[model samples]
Structure formats: C-alpha cells, structure tokens
Target: MCPLFSPPLFMQRYQFVVDFVQAHGSKKVLDLGCAECSLLKQLQYHGKGVELLVGVDKDSSSMKTRMHSFAPLSSDYLQPREGPLEIELYQGNVTQPDPITRGFDLITCIELIEHMQLEDVERFSEVLFGFMAPSAVIVSTPNADYNPLLPGLVGFRHPDHKFEWSRQEFQLWAVRLSELFGYSVSITGVGALDDAHTDVGFCSQIAVFNRKPSQNDPTNQHRSRGEPTVYRLLYSVAYPSLSDNNVLQRMLVNEVLSQAEQVKAAWLSGEWAAKMAGAREPYRQGGDICVSLLDVWACPQVKHLCGTLRRFTEALVGERRVPLTPDRQAVIVPTEEEDEEELDEEEEDEEEMAAVEARCTTTTTSVATEDWEEEITHSAVGELTACHVLAHD
Candidate 1:
C-alpha cells in the first residue's frame, strides 16, 4: 500500500526518506497529489510504524477509494485513518493555497509533476514547500530524455507537456537553487521505469534537500546579528586575489575597499569623465584565493553565502544533516584560479583536452580532511523554494 517503489535501486531512497524523517523523531507525512492514495495506504499498511500519514489530491474520485478516512485531531487538525494505520486523504488540488492541513516531517511530490500546467509549477511548488514538515523534501521527477519512445501509444504521454530536462539541466537548476537559496542538494537516485507497451523507459530523477548547521566567523564569536541578507547582489565572493597566502592577499587588497569607494563615488557622481591614477587597473583581475573561511568572513560574497547559510542553520538545528554564494551588480571580478593563462582558439582547445586527461588521472583521488573539515554538528533550516527570480537582466 505504501509506494510500490518496487525497484531494487529505489529501496535505498525509501530507507533514506525514513531515516530523514526520523531525525527529528516526528511521525507526520503529507503526500501531495496523492493519486489513488496508494502512498497513504502504504504508510497505513507498512507504516503501522510511521507517525502520521496524510494524503491530498484534487480528483474527487480519490475519495471513493477505500483509503479515505478522517478523524478530528482537534477541530482543525484531523488525524487520517486507513486499514490498521491512522491516515487521512483530502480531495483537493495542491494548487490551492489552503489544501494542506499542517506541516509534516517529510513532503513528497513524486512523478506527478508532468501532468500539471506549466505556469502552475512554480506556484504549487512554493505551496508544497510551505507544507514541508521542517526537515526535508524528497522529490522525484521524469528526466526529459525519458520521453516516450512511441508517442501515441498510451495516454501517459501528453502533447501539451510544458518542458523537459536532462541530467545537466537538472544539475544547473539545482546548483542555482543551492546558490540562490542556501540549500544543500544531492542527487539521491536515477533509474529507468519501463512502460514496455510503449517501448519507452521513464527515467526517474530524485534529489534530496538537507539543511546544514549554522556557523559564524571565529572572529565574531559572540555577536548574534542573525544572518546578513544581500537584498541586492553587490559583489561576487569570487577570488578576492591570487596570492600564495590568502590572508596576505586579502590584507594586500585591504585598500580596495577604500579605493573602490572612490571609484564608485566618481562613477556615481557623473564624474566618469575624469579617471583617477589608481583607476588604471582593469576590471576583474581574475585568480586564486587560498583563504580558509573560518577566520575571515568580511568579503561581500562570503558574507552573503555564510549569512544565508546561518539562517538555514538556525532553522534546522539538531534535525540531523549528513552535512553539507552570491552575486554582483555588474562588476566582473576575475580570479587567478581560472586565469590559467588563456590560449589562442587552437591552443585553448588543446589545453582543454589536456585538462580533461589530467582530470581522468585523478578521477578516483581523494584528499585528507583537516580537523576543521571533519564531521558536522550544526544543522541548516531551508525549504526548497523552487526559484525566486526577482529580476532578470
């Protein structure tokens, strides 16, 4: 009755979801788009051990199924029931703002995304994220490449489907999400579900979003300003400088702040016509920076990244984490790590090939962890808010 996630590879994911919710030791689960309420039944059937099971769907037919049973937990919070387990199923669409009754330990939206309207995707995503029980959200969706091999075979393939994504496409989004929202993401599983009748294999992609712990600059050990918010991306936390010792490098450019102020004031005062003697330096001097984040947390990008992470940390403390930056107005600051000496078009291509070869040599190489880089004790609080695109240039 729970998810027939019958595949051998997926058993790991089930264990993952179970262990994830048990971290905080709460027993409430809400399944959005709970079609046929199979997930609820599974919890009731298998989760006689699970804390709470709540299922929701928009189709009225979902109520006719044997899984629908509700008991009042209070006037507003009602415990659901199914078989020997306490389960609940509400016939309502996830698109509505008020469909969910309360927060849950883990919120799951599995394989049902393809059927929703393209525009509603973001809206409902936020709504669903709001329903997350403050721990983690486990999501599984179709890898766009897993499209039907024969289009007209079954009703499963819809011509009006909005868009699809490949592995890289999903990673790009995940990277951006983590960067923008300060959430940690890891791909949990990738598998193919075969619809033999259509000769098509639906590729399932799963990702886990875990909150990390809060940390502060060892320098500012006692101050509690909460986290800093970069209302607007003013700078890149890029390589501040390319030097052998990162601290020395940061100190060397300690003058950049004062110097940049003069430059910005000049540029902002309609005095762009006049150039300062120090303004001779070109934009974005690219390179490497070897500073450890523990001691100094003053750079704009560093501040933004860490501050956001702190908020997440404060939110999910003690929840459990296996463990695991920012923007620019327009100034392009380049760093030395990437400034590996550019080559002409042909030479550049060769360099890339050699880099790839070197990469292959160290493919399985691992590094020794320093004391500070050991197991984490802090936790982060974050929700997988799909994409908060406030502006585009």
Candidate 2:
C-alpha cells in the first residue's frame, strides 16, 4: 500500500491526467463524474497555474460531503469567510451537455465512460466534443486485455462497468472519435505489470485528445453552442495549495527500481530463452515471437531493463544457432518434389498469417525503436507519479 502522499496504481492515473492538463497551461478545468471531488482536491495540492476548477457528478450527496468538508479550511490562499478556493461543485449527468459555460481549456472524464452502455458512448462523445468544445480532453478506462495480469481478478474491475476495452478496441474508438471531433490523440497506460502477462502491461489506459485550433474557429462545422444552465451549483470555496514532500519522489524511485528488478529476474529465469525456442514453430508458420515479446518490453517504465533483456535474448539465440524468420524471404521454400495442391494450400495459409503478423511486427518494432531520453528528468518523474497528493490541502 502507498502512503497518503504516494498513491498506488489506480490513483496514479489521475496524476497523469492532471499533469497533462497542467502541461497545456489550462486555467478553467472541468472534471466529469468527479465523485467526491477527489481529483480536484488532488489538483489543489499538487497543481500549479490552475485558476478555476469545476467538478460535476450525478451523485449530489457525494458533492455535498466534499463541499462541506472543504468549507471550513482557512489559509493565506483560502479564507473561510470569503471562500477563496475558486472551486465549484455541481450535480449533473455527464451524458448531457455540460452545465457550465463554454471555452473551458481542459476537461477530464476518468473511469466514467465504461459505466455507460455501449450505444450511449457515441452520444457522450458528441456532448463532450461538440457541445463542450474544450481545448483538451483526457479520458481513461480499464484495459480488458490486462485483466489476466491481476492476481485473483475475475470479470470486470467494477460491477458497474458496462465494458472494459482491449488496447485495440480503445485505440479504434479513440481514432474514430478523433476523426469525428478534429482532435489528435495519444494513448498511454498506468499500473504495474506481472511477469505472467506483461504483453498488455497496464491495468488502466488513458487517451489524451488535443482539439485542433482550427476546429474551434468560427468557420468550423462543430462549434460550441455556448454554455447551458443545466446544473445547480452546490457551492464555491477556496482551496490552498499544499506543500510537497520527498515521500512521493522516493516512492517513485523505489517503484522504478522494483520494475527493473522484475525485468532482470524474468530474463535471468530463462523465460525469454524458452520463448525463443518456442519461436521456431511460430516463425515457420509466419508468426513472430520477437514481436509478441517486444510488446511486453516496449513500455517506457521498463525500457532500459527491456533493452538488456532483448540483447540477452538475441545473444542467447545467436549462441544456440537458432533461425529467425523476419519475413517471407527467410521462410523455407517448398521442394520441387512436393505436391502442387498441398504447396498451394500451405502458401495461402502462410500468406494470410504473414500479413497479420507483419502489421503487429511493424507497430511493435516502431514503439521499441522510438527515441526516448535514457535519463529520467524531474518533469518526467512528476508525469510518472501524477497521482501522488497531500492528504489534506
């Protein structure tokens, strides 16, 4: 368990979203489904340059509890009588047009989309992209393919979650939404990886979308309809920024070191060696073991360790004189004595399998080869530990 100032995997995701939001220099921020206003509270503690923070949720009772708790706190930045926090609480459904005014710089909906029915996601997107028209939007949800990584986990992560999407599924949806909304998207993950299933890695995934400036221009087709008065403001208060502690910084260092150790252990255990031997059948049948292993190794969190493991695997394969089929040219050709019909059938099957494998290989290799600074900077670490927050503010 992580300390109050250092959140675990699930909470860490909120930090990532907040970091992205802060990096964009957003002032007016709105969080959809802001249950307990926990995310807003976190921002108050760690965030910089945020001027206005608005939180909306369907549960009015939770909003009341959060508002009441923060109302009494006083500081140089926040006065109890004057209410200096610049925070607003609203009870409203996120599926509809946001009740707040237009031109919000950043909007976030974390772990909320999966609760909606599959068919309703489109409408939710329309409201978010078309009606809200924020400069940036950050969304996150559970990664279904990653469920196997969780110990004793069964079914969805939450009972209310309508569906958990696989990486491909989430990517497809993000791509479609980006096209429809004129936004560019980047996908990343949050969570620890188990050795048993490192391919999919993270338990949760996030998609950050930056709406094109041109799309917000007057001539654009999808213009915001201004603000609507749909939500009742529960209260407004001032929340002071909390001082930072070295605890979070230390915890992140420990986490990175722990992950590096895990990668080393996996490699030293001869797991990759065994996987390399298994590659023979797959490679001959037009599949790629390297590509599959690369998916697990490409994560930024363990890139250095992964590099060592990758080199070790390649070295081991070389020493064993193992053949690696990189493409069709490397595949063994059928002999002239072989039956024509049987050869034709085999070729057809191999071609189809090769096509699919080629796509996977291309993507995995690109991620593996992308240039990233070997040294981790403070900003980078801050991004990595985005969920860490003070217990109170």
Candidate 3:
C-alpha cells in the first residue's frame, strides 16, 4: 500500500470495477467470491445504471452476517431513485453452472482466483466463459514478482494463496483462456511503486476479458438457456422508487414543506434583510414575499435533491402563491397584509411554520446567504426573487 492513496490497495481494486461499470452502463452485474458483500455495498450506491446486482460466496456465514450492510437506509427515501435496483446475495461455488446468473452485462472476480486449487481454475473459467458468459469480466490477483519489493514480506502475499503467478504467467493463462473462449484479454495493474522498481509491475495484476462479438459468441448462444440456479438465495431487497405513488407523495410533501419553512426562515433572518437592504423593490408585494428559485436550488438543506424531483416539488405546491412566471424562473409566497381580517391568515401561517418545524428536523442553513448576496447584487433582488418562488399557488 502506498502512502499517497488514502483508501489503500483493496479499495482501489473495488473502485476500478465501479468506474468500469459506471462508464460502460452495465445494467446487470455479478460479483464472484463476495466476502462480507463489501463490493456489493459500494456497487449499490455508486454503480450507476446497475439494475440487478448479484453476489455469491462459498463463505455463506460471512455474507449472512453482513447482509444488512447492503440494505436500503432511512436517508435513501429522501432522494429519488435513478431506476429500480434489486440486490441479491447467495451462497455457492464459483465454478458451478448457475442459470439465474447467466448472460449478465458484467461479472467481477477480484482477488479471488489465487485462492482456488490449480485444477478448479480451469473449471471456473469454463463456467464463467462457456456456461455463464457475460459480455465483460474482470479478474485481479497478486503479482508474485512484486512480493520481494516489500521489506519484511517473504514467499506469497497471503498464507491462504495456493499459488501466486508472475506477470508473464498470469498473462499467459489469460491469453490462452481468451483464445479458447472467444474473448479478448487485456492486462493492467494497481498499487504501482516509484520509478526505481517500475519494471517489477503493480502489486496486484488484473485481466479484463471482453467477449468478442461474432456469430459464434458464447454469450449469444447461451443467452436463452434455462438452467436451474445452483446458488442458495440468502437475502434480497428492492429499494424505494419515485414510481411508487405513496413514496413520491411522502417525499414531495416533505420537500415542499421543508423548502417553504426554509424560505420563511431566510426571510426572517437579519442576514437576509441586510442582503436585501439595497434592493430596488420592497421585499414583499401586497401580502407575498419574494424568493429566488436559484437560491432555493442552492440551499444546502435540500441540495442533494435532484433537479427532476425538485420539479415535482415545484408542481405540487398547492393553494399557496408559488406560481411560476412565463419564463419558469421566478415565484412568490403570500403573507399577511395590514387588514384586520388578514390576522386570521397570519395565525394560520404561524401554525403552518410550527408544523413544518415538527415534521422536518433537518437543520436550516444560513451559510448560503453570501451566495444569494453575490447573485442578488448583480441584479435587483426583486427581479431575481421574482424569477423563482417556493409557495402554494
């Protein structure tokens, strides 16, 4: 492990797989030899476009003990989902031919093959490339050549590793498999050392295998096969999605009320008043206070909310005064005027604030005042605030 990399070597290996899936838009992914489901935990959140993620490990007890690590959390509901994501964990051997996991977009066997007996390696390749042929596969293992570089280390990096392959040996094995399975293989590595021993290569060597597109491609041939699942399903979960009406309704209500309360707090704060002191128009028009749509988008409290979800919040602000102008840039919030009957409306507003405080416990942020001040100074506060308002129409 190098001092420069904070996450160290093992995490870098996982990150490489994540970056690959994100780049290629792999919708279905399988992780072989998943210990404690660490890669699954990372892939669930960071693996973009990953709709179906499956993990298999021979160590059933390890995967079972950490099943909760990949489950959806309380905060997952606050944000909208990219799409439907389903994760499943199973206990099984990698060399077995499992019908359920076949024809995936991508498969990863990270730092796993070195632990297998020499004879099982051939069976593992036959299962992955011939039977369960995915479009792409990534495999990483220790580089025996780099073992001597470590000051106190001797022999293999891990005691459990049956055999460690030198760079040439790993590439020879990979090239032979690529030829036999009709796939293309490329070699890369991680945990690079300084210039002095660059020739020795990375501590961890990797082989990326992509099935060659052809009439005889194994993946195409096996895409429709219906083999029974060999792995035992230990756990499964589907995350909440905006497509669900109840979920969307709850999220929409919480954000609208939270934003409304935030706007109100900003209007009352002395910093907001000081920022608006030089505006050309009065802060309030009749009974409505002006708010910037841009500022609302930038507010740290709701900053994590996506632009599309914000549109829903913008649309569902019923009965309040948050009507967008023709340009769809600005809005307004209605307040109480000096009329005697308006006292009732003011009391209602106070009660509404109290309710907002109770339902939304997220701390309000005042640090964005300077951002508003900078943008407001460039144009009149009235014009900017008029562009976007968070209120019920």
lDDT minimum window of 10 residues, candidate 3:
365-374
Q: Please provide TM-scores, in order, for all candidate models, with all chains considered together.
A: 0.41, 0.55, 0.65
The candidate that achieves the highest TM-score relative to the unseen native structure: 3
The best-first sequence of candidates by lDDT reads: 3, 2, 1
What TM-score does structure 1 among the candidates reach? 0.41
Q: Write the per-residue lDDT of candidate 1 for residues 1-393, one digit (tens) a residue.
A: 112123432343344455555554436676666656554544543453454566666654544444413222221111112112234445566766552344455677655565667678766655544332234566765565554432222433334335555666766755565554445788744434444522333345676765443462121222122221211111111111122232222332333323344444444455633232222322322332221112122245334332553542332233211010122111222232233343254365456434422321111100011111111122245322212111100
Question: On residues 1-393, what C-alpha lDDT tens digit does candidate 2 reach at each position?
Answer: 222123445457668867876677777788888877888877765666776778888778777666655442324322111122367777777777743635687888877888889978988888888778788888888788876644334677655668889999999999899998889999887764446566885666889898877833522333233343777667665433222122222222333334333433454355533333333221213222222233223345334322464442443243211232344112222213557775686587557534422332111000011011011124433433112222211
Please report how far candidate 1 places residue 288 from its true position, in Å: 91
lDDT of all predictions: 0.40, 0.57, 0.67
What's the candidate order when arranged by decreasing TM-score? 3, 2, 1
- Tens-digit per-residue lDDT, 1-393, candidate 3: 113223456677778899999999998899998877778788987998788888888877777677866656656655758477777777789989878767799999988888889999989989988888899999988888887765445566555678889999999999999998888999998777579888989877899999889886665544332323677777777776666555555554455445654665676674443222332221565566655555444445344444453664455455243454344443455565347555676687557544532442221110001111111111434222211111100
Scored by lDDT, model 3 comes in at: 0.67
Between candidates 2 and 3, the TM-score winner: 3
The true-versus-predicted C-alpha distance at residue 52 of model 2, in Å, is 0.6
